[model samples]
Target: MTQWQTRRDDGRAGECAGGRGAASLSGGPSAATDAVLPRLILDHARDGIALLDIRGRVLWMNPALERMLGWPLDLMRGRNPAEFINLPENRPGPAELAKFRYLPGSSLFQQFRVTRHMRRDGTRFWNQQSHALIDTGRQDAQKMVVVTCRDITDQVRVQTALERMKDDLEHAAYHDDLTGLGNRKKLSQYLGSAPVRASIGTGRVGVLQLDLDKFKQINDTLGHAAGDAVLRHIARALGATAQQGDLVCRTGGDEFLLICCDVGSKAALMSRAKAILRASRAPLAWKDQTITPGISIGASLCRGTPPTPETCGGEALIAQADQALYAAKEEGRGRAFFYTPELGARYRAERQLARDLATAIEQGQFIVHLQPILHLRSGRVTGCEALLRWQHPTRGLLAPPEFLGAAAQAQLLPQIDYLAMNASLDALVSLRDQGFDDLCLSLNVSSAILADADYPALLNWAMQSRGLPPGCISIEILETSFMNRGAPDGCDAIARLRRLGARVALDDFGTGHAGLAHLSTVELDAIKLDRSMVGRLETDGRTRVIARAIIRLCRMLGMEVVAEGVETQAQIDILGRARCPLVQGYGVARPMPLAELPQWLLENKAFSLPVTLPPRDEPSPAAPPAGRARRRGDNSI
Candidate 1:
């Protein structure tokens, strides 16, 4: 009934304090001043203001309040506040209200909340509302509640958008974008969290580290897009194969980590590894190719008695898995292996050896030893194979088998290979200076070095600088070198060397699967029979027949046959009977340091054979010139 509670047709409140009920709102002796000041402040204020009874029935509203709700004062008066604003049903009780009472000698108490309010058009906006109890001073009337509202829709929207952006950034940081799998950071966080540690204390946790076997070959043979597709397919397969509680993560290129929290025993962990290995074998259809992926898995289990940091730490567990992975790859890829104490010990030793290798290269500790290759019929030293050795300060002289694996893993193969090549070429230069120009120095090279575009140039430079002829240098490559799909064709690399006038030989011929096939496709000067076949020559009659057949085959193919690891005269007789031209083994002579080679050749110059063989119809391939050979009484050095 108050004039201030009424609204005009323009949707605004009427004049303030124009009715008896409105005047009564000013309770003291300065009622007139109070009424005028309050009206001026409420009418000019930007925020919406409303007055309600104790029952939350709207009694009055300001012009701003009328505009904010889109409802006129006349329509809003005497109606519940909920009809216009979406207030929560549960209001503060008397005890809760007591905590909000602040000012002394006043009935004013405040409560603040954020809620949604609706307009006449049924649109909703975010509203920040403040409610306060006010003393009315009329004995018959209950205390009034003063409410103020602010439209915060824009602020709320900004805050909501910011929250969503933060969530998206967090998701991106923890996930691999290529596969949408958790990354190493996420895995680290999970493994290092307190809950995970506590769980490990109560039970066992298994970690599986997976590496794609020959993944580089895939990238080399196919394009990078194919490699990416394979990775995504593997990720999907892992996600589907993983148990509910397990976490699958892409640690880095072609490497994945899986954390299983429910591993009860070693058997359970092994079973999970087996399942992953099987899952990885499923072929992926990529473009026009059906790519069969292979993975090697290494598993480790961590069990803590009381959850010590050392026992359940992420690094230690991952290291164990990595060592097992190395072992799995060593044994041959596409399989799974569990971590053992021995593996850890070997891993530690290898790591230490890797560190020592860096020091060895720096200190000039690596040296070359020459093993003489003899002509079986003449019993004459013809050429020598350059073998790498490490003169460790504490471990004496270490052979290639003792440290080459560690060196390869440490990525020091290039440096070691270069060292061997330079040393061998220098020795060849020294031999030619001493009138042994026909003696060939065979230097072993890895596939990685052979595939390098710059390798031939490096070799040419080294030989030119040493004043050595390329014909006196023989580059020996392993059969496995030809099997690397990631590198250029072995025949191409060999041809490149041969174009430089250097002969190439396939070392360890009978040990590999494709040696016979390679002899046909690969243009080569010679083939070396593996030591395994040479070791079985006297005992295994089949080995002798195979050796004889290989020698005759190589002779017909315009190739030379060098029997390796020959240790006895009986073996030499068999090879001579087979017309094998070359023999090199411990029985002929042990590998001696470069400095000792001259004296050893001098002493062995008089060495004669016990048996003689029929002369060959054709000259042997890759044999040195007749002028390069020394007579029985000739002083070569």
Candidate 2:
């Protein structure tokens, strides 16, 4: 029984399997019977069908093939199916497919060949094809091929779209939107993985942490957009400096992290740090102005022996780098430092101090001390400079230098300043009640406080609440505060304070950038010579000339001059000869509590006549019952 069949485009055959269908094609009496069934099914099938001769020429095709491909069967006749099929770039080409020519038809359906097929109208659709071969059992038998195809264009489009969305999501998850660098998430993921942890104990991971110095000044002076531009510029420069396999990330605002793998030695790590420092120091042009930014860098090497994933944590590395970064800033910025245990200890101490500062302010653990400022001619006390002292429950009394920096870093300066000012006012009211009405209270005001527009109102409220006149309180401002003229509320705050009958004194005058220029623009009532200038008056002849010139200039400007840090008798003699009127330092009296001031004033005749200097460490008086007692021989003030 020979099975007759037709050829297909893929060199396969579709056979009429039943004897009844075979007899119908031969036009027997039962031609319209079951013999016509195979022909009917092929013509009306949902899938496209095609036939080809053994030489790979299309011989016949079903109506479904024409509908699926949008091509007329007559025009597709004798055309090679490969010409209309669009295979992916990675798919086997004709040359590779030729190797499978001798493969048996039975194995063709093991995997359906999916590819795109073009229509006569120049459009295309995806097709899944299955192949089979047929043979005519005759002396000169001709081989035929049958190819069945299904349109899968919709499925392919959906799959491709899904893959593109997946890629987009992955890119967004790992990359920073601003800098196009790996974000914290990516860094954490990398560090937690086996690759980063494997190098922990081997000292193969070097992390350099960089923080921009004075960036806050730029942000405050310029706008946020300009700040962002600066950050992008820095990121580009830092990224350019990265070696192959090194990753740079903007881990925080004005802070960056660089992770280097397989670092050879500590010197090599430092060399990289130096390069980054140099890059950071290079001036950048923003809005037609050249701005040179300084950077402090801290580097850490992972050298955990026999490291586990948890043993060398990313946070631990970052903390070590932070400690070194703090050291760099402490030594003065624009430098780099390697992580050291000493630095870590110092950072821990500073952190603990900052943490305690908030609590200290909350608990009102601070106190006010007054140091007498004397008139140069009569040697009489005219006013007192209010100084802040921390009376720790266990540490007794601590000077401002011990905790002031930590307070400033923790943003507790405003509260502490308020505390000091209110305390000074309270002491002023106490002294006024005791007939010390002429004495003025000079209190230092931070530039940060002046930057708030609400500060003037707050100050007025404090003074009014105490029933003290505004003229009795003199605000001492640091010289450096005038360096930036663009501070939003500083200049206005000062003007408002002066308008409210408060006298403004330019404190630490000789040490800052503000010279005659700043003095000309800023309205000041008094000029306090910085200690650096005063200390040199008795020692350095040139310093004496500069001091005399400054005093003369202030006198001409109608601004009173106060010499600070006047210690030795020679210094006082020099200042008096120079015609500097007011002096404030240890030569008159050390900073003492308000309760001790009256007795000290009586014993020394500080405000009326000439006062002699007491020996260092001499006990002045006992503390009041309400106030904490002072330790004898404790001359911190």
Candidate 3:
């Protein structure tokens, strides 16, 4: 048997020697030869165990401790654990450790610590260590500490991996996948955080909302892959443009929000918005095409000595910026605007009007009104133009100018156009039944409706269902409608309508920059001089010369000319002198409801005017009576 003994600091032997020490510690048999059992058990234990004296110097170690640290017990004897173990800095010092002494009747003084320990080869690993203080019975003997250490390196590795994965998940939840920018969730969280609120309370903060204009067209035309590329590119641009501590977030598709901290004034906020606008204007090259993207920005500033959350909340700031964005779009796109209370009121009103427009459409509150188109030579009613009027139940009759802007914003113009076309066809059917079978109808269609691929088929179906000839329907498109990217589609639609035996006219001509170019590119049967030109025809000589030249050009091209807004008799005389075939305005007849058309037609059927001949440079043609001259299907007025 290997007997163990304890030596005091004074080099005196204590009572805890031989089997007596084991008996005193474990309450076992007190025989020197019997000490072998406890020693054998300790040597075979899996965990590393060590014994330290009262001053924390290591006195003895089991074989497991030697194997765990790659050091023999003899070499570590009388050494402090601090020599091999890297204890945590927060661990108790000597003074604190002295307080953890063994008390009477206590189960045993013990403590557990997880810390890193260095092996003999200088590699480090985690160890879950437990310390217990032993109480010796003899007064002359010193107390001892027993420590057991379990290797926990694998468990620590697993815990570290789990923590890393948790951090990654949190990042993904708060960021946009496509752009890698902060997302709406992150924006909301940041704005609501205590730090940001404190900053807003003491300093100025600005919220800028950016919306991509014409993004839908690019997405629809070039595919979503291109759109995603554009979004990533814009994200980088915004990140570069933002100052330190500012946050750029991709709020949604084609829209981003920037939160600026410590903004000096509203002017500084607007300047930042302008910078963003300029950044977005740069063209992006995708595949074989260059896409020039445009953005509109709206900004809202919040500042006070101590602003309340109710006044400077994230939601309120975003709402204000949105209202400013609406104003920016209203004035013109690709610009910036700051929020104001008056602008918010206007936006709210328009929003309500848009909602009411949707309800109006559902309730069938819209009606068709027609103004007679009179032949200049005969002064007789030939055909009438269709005008849309809203019979608001509470607001009374509303003109197109009142609600058309809101309807456009609501994307309801196409629906309104379809309704007007159908009603006008029905009105034409009624006129045919009332002995005006030759009466034609002209309907004004917006660019969106004109560019729609399904419009021609819908029109054909409406005309067929009403038992009206396609020749009785004329489609009038604004000159500005053909000056956009959709012009090709509009031209294709016009061709389809013409093939269906319907005549097409360029309405409000001489108002657009590309009027003459449209005349050459698009095939049309008539051109309606806009009210601006006709209103100036009598007083402006330059207008007179331009009017003469346009009429002569159309006559030579075998296209009819209609003078619109001819309110004065002198204007009619001038148009007659210019050989304008048709004239329509209040001077001829104000727009009346479909129910009043038949009576008006009856009263104007016998009206006649003096026929005017063409000038010496042009070939003169005899004027036929208005009713018989230009019937449905006749291109010539």
**How much lDDT does each candidate structure score?**
0.80, 0.75, 0.80
> Please, what are the lDDT tens digits per residue for candidate 3 over residues 1-637?
2435644445555333233122342233342234454675676678999998866678998877888888888887876666655545544566655554435344434456888877888778898987787779655148787889899999999999999999889989999989989998899789878877776876577899988888888888999999998898788779978988788999989999999887868999998888887888788999999988888889898844466665566678788898898788888899999998788788888899899899998999999999988876656677899899999888899999999989988999999988888888888888888888667899998987876888899999988888877777788988777666466776788899899988999889998556777778888889999999999987899999999999989888878888999898889888888888788999889999988989888877755554464555665333354446354324332
Off by over 4 Å in 3: 1-41, 53-68, 71-75, 80-112, 116-124, 135-143, 199-203, 220-226, 241-246, 281-292, 303-311, 615-637
> Which candidate should be chosen as best, given lDDT against the real structure?
3
The weakest ten consecutive residues by lDDT in model 3 span 17-26
Give candidate 2's error at residue 336 in angstroms. 2.3
RMSD of each: 6.7, 8.9, 6.8
Candidate 2 off by > 4 Å? 1-41, 51-60, 70-80, 83-99, 102-113, 117-125, 129-148, 216-222, 280-293, 304-312, 484-489, 606-637
> What digit string (tens of lDDT, one per residue) describes model 2 on residues 1-637?
3344544335454443333223323332233335445666676578889887665558899877887777677877876666555444434566654543423445763668886766657677788888777667642226777889998999999999999999889978987778888888888887777766666656588889989888888888787777787788778878978988677888888888998876856798999999988877778888878888788999887655654443345678777888888788988888999997677777788899887787788898888999988775555566789999998877789999899778877788888888988888899899878877667788898867777678778889999998877777789888776565453345677789888878888889888577676677777778789988988887799999999899878766767788889887788878767777688888767899989998887676534433343332422221122113222111111
Looking at model 3, the pairs that clash are none
Give the per-residue Cα lDDT of candidate 2 at 494.
78
The lDDT-based order of candidates, best leading, equals: 3, 1, 2
Ranking by TM-score: 1, 3, 2
- TM-score of each candidate structure, all chains considered together: 0.86, 0.82, 0.82
Tens digits of lDDT, candidate 1, 86-130? 534444555554344224234334456788777777788998987
* Model 1 TM: 0.86
